[model samples]
Target: MINMKETINHYLAAWNEKTATAVKAAFQKCCTPDVTYTDRNAPTYTEEGGFVIKGIDLLTALVMGSHAKVPGRAFSLLTMPQYFDGHCHYSWGLHIPGQDEKAGWDYIVYNEQNLITRIVGFLPEQV
Candidate 1:
């Protein structure tokens, strides 16, 4: 039985890490070495459709770049995470002043070892 809340928080914590080392460590804690991550609004896209990011190094770089772009941004869950089997779904938002913006949804798949194997993200509108 996976602790869904803890898993979701760890995933978000990876994105909110302030330093490269911290972000990398956070990712290592929650994700597998070959974890696949894709977001609808990602800058890099493939010919097959959708940008696919594989492995921890790339994942760390992605989050670090996001930090550089947004600086001091924090991601928080907008709804309780729902889990089924090895997968989970939840909505999240960026901490913007005076706004309760539900930015998007993330569907996560974890391995039996309790490491995240993949994440599929959907952002309807850019924040």
Candidate 2:
């Protein structure tokens, strides 16, 4: 079980920086080597059943794909510290930095190894 608080913090920071490299690093740290980012129904590629960005190269591609969409977005702790048996899932109330309002909910699923396996995200709501 990993404390995602720190990981999420770095991710949100990297997003605002628009530094693709930083985001990539954070993702690599939190996710496994075979990490897959699901871009289901995303504006860019809602036609191909979403993209399965595998490995570091593809992970960076996925981050680049989302760069233009959710610029300056920051995540806020929502569900707090949660535990499920030995695994855990948590949600965050995302906010666009400088926007100062709740954007949407993003979920992160972590395994016993403290590596993220799934990432479920939604577009920001009216805020």
Candidate 3:
């Protein structure tokens, strides 16, 4: 059986890394070549309403661009992931060098091979 929690934690750690290159490497290691990622709050310029990203190459570019936009920002997990029925959910917070943290959560799905197949991230609703 796959170690669901460990897998999710690895993905989160990759996301929290300081550099985009690290993020890309992490994704390549943990996700399948055709993994799909959807970020609800992604800027409209790069994606549509769903912000769907298909393939590891495209996903790496997206993450690199995001990191370029905010050079010093990184993600930090706020709570342990909750897993049930083949899905995993966890909360996270964004850290910037001189700014307050922004929080969010991600829902992830994995394939039988223990690679992440899809991930959907949701930020707190704006006031």
The top-ranked prediction according to TM-score is 1
lDDT of 3 at 110: 80
1 or 3, which is superior by lDDT? 1
Q: What is the TM-score of each candidate against the true structure?
A: 0.85, 0.64, 0.81
Clashes of each: 0, 0, 0
Alpha-carbon lDDT, every model: 0.80, 0.57, 0.74
| lDDT for each residue of candidate 1 in 1-127, tens digit (9 for 90 to 100) | 2587787788899888888799888888888899999886456422334488888888887787777676677888888989878988999988754656547889999877668899999875755
Candidate 2 wrong stretches, greater than 4 Å: 10-14, 39-51, 97-100, 125-127
Residue pairs with backbone overlap in model 3: none
Q: Native-vs-model 1 lDDT?
A: 0.80
What C-alpha lDDT, on a 0 to 100 scale, does residue 105 get in candidate 2? 50
* RMSD to truth, every model: 3.2, 3.7, 2.8
State the weakest 10-residue window (summed lDDT) of model 1.
41-50
lDDT by residue (16-65, candidate 2, tens digit) is: 44566777777667677676555444436322344555565465665565
TM-score: model 2 vs. ground truth? 0.64
